[model samples]
Target: MNPEAWVALALSLKVAAWATAINLLLGTAMGFALARWRFPGRELLDALLTLPMVLPPTVLGYYLLVLLGKRGWLGGWLHEQLGITLIFSWQGAVVAASVVAFPLVLKSARAAFENVDPQLERAARVLGLSEAAVFMRVSLPMAWRGILAGVLLAFARALGEFGATLMVAGSIPGQTQTLSIAVYEAVQAGQDASANTLVLITSLSCIAVLLSARWLAPQRSAA
Candidate 1:
């Protein structure tokens, strides 16, 4: 591993960590709402949220480019009003990774919240617990393991995000280039040794995260 490899790894970790953190808050809240609240178009909302999981990466990238490009509606406003530019930057990579990895957390959190016994929640409410208190003390505790499993999976997904990141952030060495992009660049440049090292690191990291997720996931008892 060389300095470039280490830089890519560090940048990848930074992007993944930020993306995961954003999803943790958003996914958990959205999942809990989808699980607990019955509303019109709930299924439609879920499908839309999960769209990135099934959409081709290039398509997703195109969508992002359109939305965040310098001339784009949101992007134009952001650049003009806040002096912020997301496209072609590491921050854009974070956004791309977050969109790509969000479904994992959302789906996991929904399942976890749904699996929590409504009776227990009602009982807490009966015992004079506020809705927030009941959620913090009872709901969250029961659903933590499953939620954590989803979080780990999201982290792994974010760490390996390639296409969307590439399109939105581009491959700027030591800046926007992530582990996956690094591997691609290495292979393109015929740096087989570097590519091999990056591939090994990525595989090992993802494998470790997946195993931990499996261990943390809720287990069904024998029927």
Candidate 2:
């Protein structure tokens, strides 16, 4: 294997890890809000949250590119205020992966939050526990297994993200190239050995994550 291949693998892992972490935090918060709150436009938010799951990855990537491009509103503001550029960079890959993987985490976390009995929360409140304390102590622990499963699922999704990432990050070798991008480039260039190796690695990673999620799911049910 070329040193470039190893560099691509490490960068891919780094991007995926950061993307999964951001998705886990944001998705969990969104899920909790959806399950517990009754705010105006809640339905709209829910629909938008699930949009990426339904849309083509290329479409999602295109929209993100526009939204994060230098001339775009948010992108302009970011560049002016923070002097940061997101497009065609490793950080951009992380953002794209997080956007695409968010729905999985949100769905899992919402279901987990809903499964916890409201009565338990009420009892905690009666016992003089603050809302935050009740949630941290009584609710979060009960849903920990589901949250773990959600995080794993998000991690898997992020690892496999290709279209959106490619469009936004541009497959720069040793910089923004990820496992999926590497595989695609190798196949295009008729580098079958490298492509095959990448495919095998990706498949194994996916299988391992799925198995772990399944194992954790049963624990959530038991709890």
Top lDDT prediction, candidate number: 1
Lowest-sum lDDT 10-residue window in model 1: 214-223
Tens digit of per-residue lDDT, candidate 2, span 1-223: 6787778778877988998899888998888889889999988999899899889999999999999999989888999999999999999999999999899889888888989999999999999999889889988888777778778988988998999999999988988999899999999999999998888888887898899788877876787
lDDT of each: 0.93, 0.89
Lowest lDDT 10-mer window, candidate 2? 1-10
Error of 2 at 37 (Å): 0.7
Q: Of the candidates shown, which would achieve the greatest TM-score relative to the real structure?
A: 1
Tell me the TM-score of model 1.
0.94
